[model samples]
Target: MATNLFQRFKTDISGIELPEKFTFPFYYEPHILSKIAAQELQNYLQSQTDFEHNFGLEENQKGLIIGKMFGVLVCQNKEGELGYLWAFSGKLANVNHLPYFVPTIFDMLHEDGFFRKEEEILNSINRQIEFLENSDELRTKEIQLQATKIEAATDIQNQKNKIKRLKIERDEKRNSFTNLSLSENGTSNCELVKQTLEHELSEESKRESILLKKMTKYWNFQIMNAQKEVDLFLDKINSLKEERRQKSGTLQQKLFAEYSFLNLYGERKSIGEIFDNNPPAGAGECAAPKLLHYAFNHQFKPIAMAEFWWGQSPKSEIRKHKQFYPACKSKCEPILLSHMLKGLDMYANPFQENPAEGKEIEIVYEDEILLVVNKPAEFLSVPGKIITDSVYQRVKKLYPNATGPLIVHRLDMSTSGLLLIAKNEEAYKQLQSQFIRRTIKKRYVALLDGIINKNEGVIELPLRVDLDDRPRQLVCYEHGKFAQTRWEVIAVENNKTRVHFYPITGRTHQLRVHASHELGLHTPIIGDDLYGTKSNRLHLHAECLTFMHPISKEEITIQKAAEF
Candidate 1:
């Protein structure tokens, strides 16, 4: 008789002895096929590190006394994702005898619940489509609104232009009329002609009066019409601006909602503080260092916090006084906080009484158009109104006849190196054009953490500032602007590598970010706050710059030794 395929898969082992009698149909299966499937699943898991696990078979069964089972078959996969099999009492069947049963059973079970999976996938796709459509609609509406505002602004500007043109035309007409050799110390030229004609004098005088009245009326009409158009245009501008603000507000709400939904599971952050809470740092022009210190400490009075951080006050003086300690006789908490914070000069420094007189800075090169200088670290490249000892100030003093010495480029405050200066506006504009066109070349030397693999190669990576963390950057593949740099290893010591960098783009903190994050070298220039590994000093130096001279039309190259 042909046995049931599933019956061969089962074995009975209630004890050391097989069961004497069986009540249920004993249909057991080995996990040989399931183990094979698990192996494939392991390969799939290997592709995704965040979703990881181990999969292996761990079981052995002994058989069967004369048509009776003594051992059992067992298999298990972690996570309880798969746990379905049968146990029975009988002679143990070899896996070869029942190949079709396990596959058929697993397939049947999978099909039983497959529709739910398909429905879930379809739902996810629908949600994404809906979100995309909404976003497009909002964007289109915003663009249309902006276009309307721009049209209104343009109309107002055109009206003003028309008014100016009308004024000019009227003035010219009036000047020509008054200077027509008709209104002078002598009688009017028309009057003199009329006098000679005698009988025609009365007729000519009447015609002249009529002509003057007509000209005056025409000029007044034109002026009034131009002024009316100007007023109408200004009114339209104001109305359109109000409409733009409303549309902008709508767009902001939609965008903020979308952002919140997508980032629900991400790090939580807030744009504005709660009513009574103060932001750790305020936004825009009122970034008070003292208030920021207070917020960082997280100790706040509701009224004081609201006023200082949000530029708002409590409803009444009583609430203000109760919640926040009053400042003498004033009811405003922000005013009190600002005064209290400003009074503490913990971070402020006093002017030196008889400070050391700065030495005259060295001028590497100078001419009629430009000057090149070896700038010392910690010295300002260009002088501020308050600065007395900057390289730019010194150069201006040395060439007293020169005017408006412009800084063409600059090195960082902690970086000491060579720089070029334009002496006049023409040279400044020429040099600026060269920089904008990427015709100038800048190179630097840096000591890195470890020796890079290639003795000499290139690192093609993009960089941008991390505005949130203040003076840091991350690998932003999606939104970052493009930046490129070429690096070559100069020398390899026991562990550290000396590398030379030539930046094709002059982005802020480009070289430091590329070396540390892209190359995984973690190399930073000495004294740099964002990229340096230690606080002692950074290990980078601006060693060279090469460009064409704006006036002399000669190739110029400036070089400096690494500062340490």
Candidate 2:
């Protein structure tokens, strides 16, 4: 079959027009055909022995399945006949398996190919790295030795304390003899006691100093040498990993260059050009795109499509068994967007069009140096990359001469309520200072999606944006900023818990991440699309803002109630 084809008004093979609705490749509501396929797949999985039993039973079981993603793509033939194609993420599980699905766009597993050789070489490197890791047990033994040395040093100190006590008692006895030395015999006894005490004290001081020196000097060379060996081993492993990445990246680019992608319009784009930044690791390897590409090239009308996860979820992210997921942003977004059956109910691009249309910025309080307003949901607090209608623009219109950034603190676009705007440079500096010093107190009222066991607690999780996916943050200890939120449940409403949030240190998505992270509240805020499921609106609102007035130095408090 021809691998790639560009769009046309009508295929020479069929006179049918393309489907009217453009399918947004990434996020979509599954079609009826997809639902049926998913149900069948789920039924098949249930018959398998341990499909759902132990997957999420423990925290450690995540990402252990080595699972594969599967998809069912619906297609119509040139004669207007409809059928579905089944495909897997990378390759069929077994090489000898009977063919039940559409063949992959290209056999990624051709034994005589360059790809196979590169993969084999990469495997060899991985094996060496693993062997090195297993053989290096010196670090564990070094820790044990470190503890043993500390205990031995402690024992010597205890002995030194005992000797000091004994010396003190002898000195007291010698003093008593001195007071009673009127007789010659008493004087002789006093002299004997003093000599004994002086000899014992000198011996104890000498032993203590010698023991202390031994503690410092003993095993010093061996331990240092052992630590150096462990560090060198780790460094070698890191160096190999970098080399492996470079090798894999080169292979990825080569494969991407050879492959071409197809869209619903029947347009063609080379995978290499689709990903100008870097070709994703597994390009044209996904099930849905593979099926669609084959069908389109074979002159079949590509219809609806769906992909479902087949195994345990990763620890950091949540995924349900049999639940469908959108194409991955880092790996599959560009590919899918370039090659899905298009013209099927496309998603709107809020960035290109005005996202804040028909919205009004409500000013709560206005003064010569400040503006306080209720920021509407979906409205940016300041000018954003794509959406420019913001509270900053509104305030700028109201006070054209106002200097400094008028928008002080920003609320997430999905969040609604109180916002403070500084009108002048001096006022902005003073207010910003209060925020840096944490003198500014702000409260957010949120409704959690699930019941929260604790009534009140504090969450301190380091957070960083998932660079692989934009606008989403995760709890990453290695590279994250400190974020803290104190929460107290206010009320429970209709199987949901309403909570009060007092932020101590502000970071992007601070409250949202704290509420959803397992180490934190372990409950996502209601209607959090990024962390939780999508809903009508985000059930979070910045209800209050309190800070010392920049000029008056008086405490100011602002409050707004959340709507559901």
Best by lDDT: 2
Q: List TM-score per model, in order.
A: 0.39, 0.67
Query: lDDT of each model, Cα atoms only?
Result: 0.45, 0.72
Residue-wise C-alpha lDDT for candidate 1, range 35-100, written one tens digit per residue: 333233233333644321121111232322122111111222233222222211111142211221
For model 2, the stretches where C-alpha displacement exceeds 4 angstroms are: 1-20, 27-36, 48-74, 77-107, 118-253, 264-268, 283-288, 306-312, 318-324, 338-347
Candidate 2 residue 329 Cα shift, in angstroms, is 2.5
Top candidate (TM-score): 2
Model 2 per-residue lDDT tens digits across residues 340-366: 545545555434666578999787777
| Residue 271 of model 1, lDDT score | 22
Prediction 1 global C-alpha lDDT? 0.45
Candidate 2 CA-lDDT value: 0.72
